[model samples]
Target chain A: MPDGGDPTALGFRPALETVIPLARAGPIMLRVGVNGYGTIGKRVADAVRAQPDMEVAGVAKTRPNFEAERAVAKDFPLYAAVEERADQFGEAGIDLAGMVEELVETADVMVDATPSGIGAENKSLYEEHDTPALYQGGEDEDLVDTSFNARANYADAAGADHVRVVSCNTTGLSRLVAPLEEEYGIEKVRATLVRRGGDPAQSGRGPINDILPNPRTLPSHHGPDVKTIFPDLAIDTLGLKVPATLMHTHSINVTLDSDATADAVRDLLRDESRLFVIPERLDIDGAGALKEFALDAGRPRGDLWENCIWGESITVEDDDLYLFQAIHQESDVVPENVDAIRAVTGSADAAESVATTDDALDMGF
Target chain B: MPDGGDPTALGFRPALETVIPLARAGPIMLRVGVNGYGTIGKRVADAVRAQPDMEVAGVAKTRPNFEAERAVAKDFPLYAAVEERADQFGEAGIDLAGMVEELVETADVMVDATPSGIGAENKSLYEEHDTPALYQGGEDEDLVDTSFNARANYADAAGADHVRVVSCNTTGLSRLVAPLEEEYGIEKVRATLVRRGGDPAQSGRGPINDILPNPRTLPSHHGPDVKTIFPDLAIDTLGLKVPATLMHTHSINVTLDSDATADAVRDLLRDESRLFVIPERLDIDGAGALKEFALDAGRPRGDLWENCIWGESITVEDDDLYLFQAIHQESDVVPENVDAIRAVTGSADAAESVATTDDALDMGF
Candidate 1:
């Protein structure tokens, strides 16, 4: 298989080896378990199945709904809550596991896609079984060992057992902010989160006809949320909710300590690999087309996984900077979860894992 | 009465004075004419009446609608379209010595709060009468000699005959970006605009359940739109729209050419008069409370009118920065409008005008 060479030679920090020690470990037949079959869990399971070295050991759903039936059809093992012993799975002729714990303990890595605070509860379950866990962005920043972004903080997750993916808003902000922070020292980060009311699967979300102010709280701790990845970093966030669902958009302003020109800053951002700086001349309309572009790029699950940055939005005078970017929360974090699995299991080098994952990605047309 | 000193001594730039001369030409009984009385116009009429230095010259509406009747109730010298009855004003005990053309010519200044493109057409009428005109934010950038912001560019409008107020998005960006640019060298500006589907009066505003990308246009030209005030700015913008109505939120990212710390940058921003740095402990909730805060601050309109910046969002690691803020477009621009009027007409000293305008704002409870 494509072990690709010495894991240590993969340009990763020395600490990563403890997590995934490279012995002649015959391609570890890792079992992947997903606790929640919501938007994120579904994507995670699908992605895991596509990996050459991993398998969707099984997945657990809270209810035996349409999604559960669909999972059953895939011939992947399915488990339903004991209380919901509804024979939906049996009717679908699929063997059903008794409980979520079965799926959790059976897997080498468990990804908890439960709603925000619920991830903390599953964190304990994953720990009890000594099964490593990957978490979604919704969980609080304090819950995990570190927040992982394959490109930005792959090494940070090395030798760690638990990782939390920052919220969709934070993921988008971190990706854009990291590049700028890397190239230019960031002084202040001011952002307005134009959040979507509900996911396609969710119907109860929204302010409906009214333009409501989400939490007027400043620095939403989102800047700090990103900091879980880059500690000792100072950042703040302000948030707002709007009626939209496909993607989250962020307007950002940064004040640098020293004066730099706009062109110079743009040059720095362009150098980052995962960030695709949209040129000023593209007549691209919105996130939809960008999503299509990502899909066309053959990203698995139609994920426009990279941050789509607009070029003209770069402005610099004195030492300040401003720009805008769109972040697809669903897919951006998907790739990270894959990387985390490798980190916790000590299966591959961070760089090698990232490269392989990038290659494995179906950059779909 | 608080002219303070030579109107020219007030840091007023000569470039701005060439367009709108100081009304210091002695309490000039400037005749005001309103062609369309929609949301903005109605507000303008109220604002004009609130001014001790200016008086209602005359008003005109499309027809006898409830709005028109409301304007009439304000005791505004109302005139029907000269097209409907060329002699109606004369017959209704109103002076018609000069026709609409002559009326426009007679006014010292005309404020056009018509819909977007309509303001540009009225320009010639104002010009024909040797009167300067103030256009609303909806008009395109190229339609006027200058775009005005009392705090940032009032001096730029000193002598211009025609001035445009930038779009609400532009106005918000400019206010926030200007101070950052001034205190810290601005490197680049990126913004995602979560725009409202409609104003409060429009019923078909939004269902806002789907997050759609507004325009994938870069630099949203908002930074450039702001540059109309400070022409030398190097700014770019990317814009996205979310279904919202209360106010527009922007997520801005700025990259500095050189390295600076986040704390240093935050300190610089805190000093700017136009920006209201939300203290870390205020516990304010969202745009709604911020609006109320602005109103309680006695802002003329219940919008923050200033950028509601979160201090915590300011982060610095090496050279990157991040931040979030909310801009109340409706009322934020109002103060700028008042200042622009003074700037164009040379009616008040820049310092005095700023102070008075600031004091007049009803920030709200």
Candidate 2:
């Protein structure tokens, strides 16, 4: 009876603990409204719907464009983001859920995806409805109480009124940094980001045939942005804008506080669900091939939600570590946006939320 | 008269050095035959024509196309690379300067810019004719006895049977490194190359919208290639391919042997004629803006022969140094090829050939 009760069976004193299903532990059907139903917003809405604890309350867009049409086709309630532009939807014969105000009022949390400065401008509207909001990376860091990367500083976001998910590049760096800092402790980090000039659909942004230093300066805004997450972490980032539209490839070097081997570092990165350590045998050369690989795998919209890190590139020289990783700018943050919802609402801890989000999105490859 | 040559007037022991006309110092009317007159070949032909000691013996093309037409229009003697395809030149109403064999036999040196491995295959022909040859960066490092960067190893190339001008990115790096290594003594270098997908006319090449790890591995060939010029130098390079075809931008980090201020470093880089320190007042944002600036400045073919280093980006933290520089892929190596001709001929020292090449091409911005 003592052995069956496990008190005697366990050699060490077993701590009494209960494991719960991660699915609905976070929330009970938390309604989420996503504004700016473009590349990221639509994906977030779909991801939110897939979460057992969350559901899409509605989506807001300025026009009844193709993306809005697709949102409607997905059975997502669509609302006009700009109240004055509501009639344009009716003129286009599109069904409407309500104005953005009603969507904000009904939602437990609002995810703002407005381009750049507009996210800050939309902050007041969310506050007026007393609905805590999540902002994308493009907005100014000062606008939010805290910048969130689930793996890096998830707890900092708990119950925060306005939390911003760092940009795709920042998110990728944060995820990589989190495990490295935890395992070995970091001395400093140096990263060079070769950024895509534009999204695939965006034809306007380009050098078309040239690489540009994004800021043509050292510690290009990214380092300061990363500091917003791990405020004390020493980092320097350089950026180059290239013609690529697929993903942002990062050349990363981290100086660890303690000596570590390449294999150990690879193992650590592999343990991270968000960091996909690309194996040698796969023979995936570049982003072009990576996208093709994604399409072949039948991923949604051919999206890669994880940082596709090359395994062999994870090399350690003394206490210094070096590797190359690609961040799918359009979609890496989609899952982060999902995790931010749980983080900002105090519904789930980092582990449960990351696991649940990964499970819901089929995150690991 | 006292100040001109007297050690007493100088107040210091003056090492006597001779000043001579840099022009025509390298070779006595050296005849140079250019092979594969495409993006690099045609530009080299133009640059060679501008050198006082050099003359274009002829140029060979596999096909009589637009570039061939441009070569012929520029009065560069044109020849058929493939004997079987000789009729193509005649069919295109282009006058032939005879077969590639005739050009190789007549010229003192053959500059082979044939696609990658093709340059190696053409190497034996140059040796057969007992003609010294200069190969472009695309050729394997083993193909050349010495890899030439006029500023770094001009003397090494002297009297060498074959020399390879390191690639555009490598040339830019070497030029930057030469001064740094000379002044501060370099401990190590880490460079990330954001490469263009293709040459401007090359519509076939692209991620078009994706960034890719060129090798998806550590120590991309660039570091090894740079080592070809600086054999003892420790360098680790990573490469990313982007949609831009205009140029390749490099994010550079060097751990110097000594601590230095950014101002002193800037002044040193400014003294190097091949390094164009882009002043902040220029307001050039990226490669696109840089190209427009080039055209406006009346640069021939808008060619940027110098490494365009952003002045403000240069920073020093402890012993670490960082900056960003852009390499105009199509034309940066043009002047290097010109210097290699002089170096191989044992005509000029590093200072002489570099100044000669710079003066001939109107190199500095």
Candidate 3:
């Protein structure tokens, strides 16, 4: 009777308002098992920990490594990715909660942040457990029923068994394209991607002193990746790889179906929680500066989940829109992975999931 | 009469394919005085040395520096910029050929590459010697009646008393716009300028690890500067300063008056002598890589005088055209400065001047 919260039955006058989530009542928390435990995986696990309705079931790693030790240190109940390598963790002085299969069976949903092609191989394992899996952008489109971007097509992933979150560039494009398409119809999108050469720890990758065309062709793979979210939208993407390892800078131009002023578009973008419209007062210059700002702001690993859109660069002339935005490749998709968990599990709607993920992860500048 | 080729008088014994000039008939070599022996001035002096019709009368510097010594090593006479401080060169153990007044009187035209506002102060000196001067882009638009971009407004500077070569960004834009305006016609232009922090040696100028909006406003000064060359062309630019010290990258979207295919635009831009449409096979990534490539190719100072326009980025959707081009801030304007010399002196037509400067500097990729 006390748990039912029937104030009238308790013989006490009911309060003027009843808080739906009474102090005693908590939201349903889902156990999300993170696979791969690398850049995307570890960040997503931490994000899940921040969410009110999500908790890290555990993290699965291939073998005993620094990440596995860090996972153990976080008390995340580390699991061995390979059953045969389970003894390796013990030898490395790391404790394993169980095998990855057990984590998969226990988790409400599995986030596969494994390297690109490995996710495809992990599919059968996910199917064996009958557990829904959310794969990262590196995975092929055919591996999942739909490619996911929280802003562009989050609902397309709701209640879905297999979902693929697009790459950083695609995610950035989708986030910008969503509101524009919603507020004012979009005709075509053309983006020039100045991508960073590699992640901070990548040693073999390069352009160390150069800028190379990612594909040196028209309509790079990024445009098709974006199409996965908005199937009918026409987008042409050209990519260039630069020496910097900071972030990807995109020069975007969207031809609108109707006329809109720069101010109007700025307002529309500002309203979006994920689009961090950089104000004029803040002197964020490029990806390097953005990272400094994020680190100073005490964001986890200085991960920026928002599209750092230069507010001043958003200009409109007739039906054309132009803007420059920088996307922190390593972390922008982390929140999307978190939101994708809620999406695939049907735990929340797009707004609810995004809001929850944003609040928990401290999204936006 | 022997110096002047007359086919009528020599017809009786003239060969069927007689050349315009005999081997002994030398061309008119103009004495070009270079004022200010810094970055642009030194390059110009070397370019003048390479030109068959031009010679460096002397280079003037306020104080004896390494550049002055270097100039003397090249067998070019050096002059003191500050007449009163002429003894400074003697004290520095750098011998001067003459004073500024003598250099100005001896030269036919002066190329003023002095610090920004200093060019305005030197104008009276050129007038006192009844000499025309070609000023660098740093000088105000009002400092000269015409601002010169060889491809865009070479004729406008013809025989003018004073002329200013547009800035690096403006020159890059002008070169790209020239052909587009002639073939497709432009409705309007919107550009995003990702500028370098400063020259390689300017220790104090920096974003070092930040991306700062140069002005954090719409319609940056660059757009108006471009208009100085093409008064009626509409352009809006947003400026950003990054930690880089190599080049300025511009994201451009032009609303063309007519429709054109991407291939056709690429072909047009490729045909331009000064626009190096980066070939996909070259694999040059950005400014840093470009410098490395140029150094490998044995270019002087690894200077890229051409506008590095990405061929793959050229896209067309109905009436809108989009592309990204990088301007080498240090050396792209060097050729333009050379052309401005011909412009103010009326030494050659636009094509002739451009060809002469290009051949002299070994320009283009």
Highest-scoring model, lDDT: 2
List, residue by residue over B157-207, the lDDT tens digit for candidate 2.
Answer: 765667898899899999999999999999989888888888778889876
Error of 1 at A101 (Å): 3.4
lDDT of 1 by residue, B267-348 (tens): 7777755677777676654566666666677654464666776666565544435566667666566666666677677777
lDDT of 3 by residue, A1-365 (tens): 01123434644212212212331265666778998999889998998898898788889999887888889889998988888888999999998899998888888788999998999999998777767789999999999989999887888875566899999889999999989999999998877777777888887887543445566556679999999999999887777665567788877778899889999999999999989998867876677767878999999898888899998888786677888898988998988998888777666778888887887776666
Poorly placed runs, candidate 2 (over 4 Å) = A1-27, B1-27, B61-63, B66-102
TM-score of chain A of 3: 0.91
Single out the weakest 10-residue window by summed lDDT for candidate 3 chain B.
B12-21
Q: Score residue B245 of candidate 2 by CA lDDT.
A: 75
lDDT ranking of the models? 2, 3, 1
Best by TM-score: 2
- Give each model's whole-structure lDDT: 0.65, 0.85, 0.80
Considering only the true interface residues, what is the Cα RMSD of candidate 1 after superposition? 4.7
- Please identify which of the two predictions, 1 or 3, would achieve the higher DockQ against the true structure: 1
Q: Which 10-residue span in candidate 3 chain A carries the lowest summed lDDT?
A: A12-21
Candidate 3, which CAPRI tier?
incorrect
Question: Candidate 1 docking category?
Answer: acceptable
